[model samples]
Target: MFKTFVASALLISCASAISSFDSYKKSQKSNFTQEKSQFSDYKKAQQKAFSSYIKELEKYWKKPIMTSKKKLVSYAKDKKSRTIIDFGHNRLTIETLAKETQEAEQKLSLALVQAVTFNTEDFYNNDEFEQQLAKIEASHKIATPKIDAEPVLAPIFFKEQPTKKSLYHFVKHNITPEKIQIQKSSKIKTDKVYTLTISLPKDATIKRSFIYYEDVKREATRQQIPLALVFAIIHSESSFNPMARSYVPAYGLMQIVPRTAGIDAYYHLYKKKRLVGSSYLYNSKNNIKMGSAYLHVLYYKYLHHIKNPTSRLYCTIAAYNTGAGNVARAFVGTNDTYRAAQMINRLTPEEVYTRLLKDLRYSEAKRYLMKVRKRMKLYKKIYES
Candidate 1:
């Protein structure tokens, strides 16, 4: 009777564990599906406050679109350049131009401070309808039009942040009404606008953007990801744009996709799958933690079997931008990663690097790999310092 009771208790415990695990898996899948279904709303949230700023305002013509209003500001930063453009309602006189120049300096300072501080909560907000909509969805009322708060900020990338001037001088340019070409807008046009442009060189931009080093080093070391690589990827991905958002809808300093990279990294750190929100990703500390974890997943899990560390690093860089499947195909002409590892193993790291530069599936991926590697080398001193 004693042995039978013990056996019965063991079976009950096993059944309970199995039931709990099944419930966990089911919940994770449900969360993923629901998050994916709301992609449209979540994506729209990428644009900061929609409250009349974007809807009612007229914008200018540029490679990326911007709503040009009175004293509008925009920033473009990459590995080699930093650009800040501001629009004014009237064509500036010499005095006004000087004022605008000072303002331009202020705008650059603001951008850097935002990068340095990662204080971008104002940018990733949702409207009343979005909030209620989220609730309704949680309650499975998909068809109901729920009330959401009206959004009032600009898009995260398009949104301006805080700071003043850097040490380097800006190559300043001014554009009068005739020189400027804006996008045609249905909204009442504010006539006679002028523009101020400030262009900062690569080094100056790097110095300004490379803040939050202590946090980055801490997170990278904790995740066992290379500190230089973390810094390089951040510089290359956002050019240290704390509030940067790509059309891929990747968010924050590291440009992590909410579902894919973000979820994986969150799971790696906490053992729970979670979709990171844009505001959450905008925080530099949170962004680096997720970014470093994803890189660890890439190098240690997805690309682990490759024989050479140097060769593996190259593949990891390529995979980070493109993917493991593409990296595999680049080497062995197959998408089977383990099979490609055999081919990569036979080559020296130098050989793998050269071949990747030559044979990657997309020019953009190849360029991305190059940019990250170059920036990584550039960050080595920063890391050491």
Candidate 2:
């Protein structure tokens, strides 16, 4: 549950959290109504389609189909090799049953080949599938899609032979116990449960970062933040996992929580208080933009009062993981931001960094600050020229 930055940023203490987002939205309804939403029609249609997708899920509830966001690619995992039999007494009932033969390899291979060209574009906004299925393919070096659900330069599944592995191995690190069970029972003939885990070239770190560099460069520069810093944040947050999520329920590339970071970033950009949903945040372009804007808010707004520029950055970085209040307490023993800045002005940048590393309340925040800082240098040395 990392990247609770904005949720923690505005609060004075854990006892006093952000006011109910509903209350905030009601107050800003006038300004919100004035803003033209570009995706209203599309989201409406998507909502209708989701109703159908949910019904479709009833047919595969026991062996739910996990898939890439839109490219329709999938990493098919089955447990016939291990737990082939169990309590049929608590049997999962579905609207339909698997038409695939009882043969495990045939069941797996057929679904794999069919998924090679299948696109889940219609079901891209399906959160249940997105969370469990895991996003495997990221778009190539292209413009972020104009439509939130569309993918730009998305390679067809199984098209690239550069890198791949079995689905079981690829997902072991990220899968939940429930997901593990679903993978075992999946044998639906037409469900497009692919076995081959199609992935981008992870042979080099740059290869992964390059996939989203165009968008990162644009947003970082537009926000007047360092390009390397943004790159480093993405690197540290999810290791370039586009579908990354945290139990904090943060979503997409930056692990942005809709209620907190998303709301803050949207308000900063549009001057309207609104709750951004996971579907919108799942779009890599939107995620990076919001994350960069959040970072901009941290540096230029929350931590802006510190006299030393470098000191401001260290605090900003720490505050990006913890909160401005936490960082404030680290220096001044009180959660008063203005007082913290006053104390920070009296010390050198080194003093500020040392204090954060040594005294920040959360170990995660200290480690997070160090990781992002180190990755910033790595990104600078290797990619920034």
Candidate 3:
């Protein structure tokens, strides 16, 4: 009976694999046929749509400015003699004005469709579709297995003085050593042990800190991220300076670029459009809120496959400094083009950390990761203590 059951399971698995492969082949054939059939018509449609849209936009812009005098004169005249100023300054009946507006709006809708469908071939050229297909194939190649819990990182020890040994340990473990403090031994005896402290910059102290503690804590809690991690990021980015601005023109404590990460987080979290000419990021509360929200997106959205909390935090921190694309590149090997999340799912936490440290392209990004990690430890020690 046992042999029969095992044999039946093996046959089922084989059938499923074969079915999946056939489905993939059918999808490929369909995509190819659709592309070939639509190629010429797609270009012609795009050109026609854009030309119509431009004509409508010109009409909209050239709409006549109806002066008060003209309105009064028109109103005084009989319906047959009276003429409303239509678009392009042409005198016409009110019905014509309404008709033109409706036509223009319709043309605008067609233009949008053209814009979206323009250069459909370019989409396939990027190989993203192929990569996604590959990922799906890989997923089906194996059955789902139980996931093991990640191992906890050991506590880091900071000595009284900065030594080569301590520095080496910090680098090996990917910790940032921001500040070192040496304390005199309190003991009167000739042989006494002294305490060495690893601290953040003086600007990070509460007295000089620009971030509102309550707001950061609240936002971090809302995002389900650690408060220490938020604090450390702000410390590394701007050293808690609310007015800080980076060379990239990233503003406020978290140094967010208003157009990129800021807008992305704003739309994702608030479910609203970010308007132009807004300077909300300069406000400490708003900056921390947006920055924290962006970090949340990076961790849970982009690096979601990294199961270990520590590994995810590290990759998210790196992504914050650099772009998420760069972080993904580090994971799949610099030379490889696999999607970051898909590749990350196949590796251990330690492997992810090691690859990030060694394979990241930019030296600055590598340093940024180290600094953020180091500051995180310091902030955790000070605030959580």
Summed backbone clashes in each candidate are 19, 2, 2
Relative to the true structure, candidate 2 reaches a TM of: 0.60
**Model 3: per-residue Cα lDDT over 89-185, one tens digit each:** 2122321111233342333232222222222122222223222323332332311121111110111123243355554555334221222122233
Q: Compute the lDDT for candidate 2.
A: 0.59
Q: What lDDT would candidate 1 get against the real structure?
A: 0.59
Q: Which stretches of candidate 2 lie over 4 Å from their true place?
A: 1-102, 107-205
Candidate 2 residue pairs in clash (backbone atoms < 3 Å)? 76-194, 76-195
- Residue 188's C-alpha lDDT in candidate 2? 49
TM-score of each: 0.69, 0.60, 0.46
Pairs that collide, model 3: 160-196, 176-374
**Cα RMSD to the true fold for all candidates:** 9.2, 14.6, 27.5
Off by over 4 Å in 1: 44-55, 59-64, 67-190
lDDT, model 3: 0.52
Expressed as tens digits, the lDDT of each residue in 7-110 for candidate 2 is 67546453343455555666567554442242243334445554665566545455434222211222223322211100112111111123333343444434
Off by over 4 Å in 3: 1-206, 275-278, 333-338
How would you encode candidate 1's per-residue C-alpha lDDT over 1-385 as one tens digit per residue?
Answer: 9999999999999999999999989988897678666654654543443343334232322222332211112323221112232211212111111123345344444443333233333222222322332443344323222222211122222223322332121112223334332233322243222233333332543453445577788888887877889887876776665555665667667888876887789899999765656556656777888899999998999989997988998899898888899999998888899998988889999999999999999998899888888878877866566
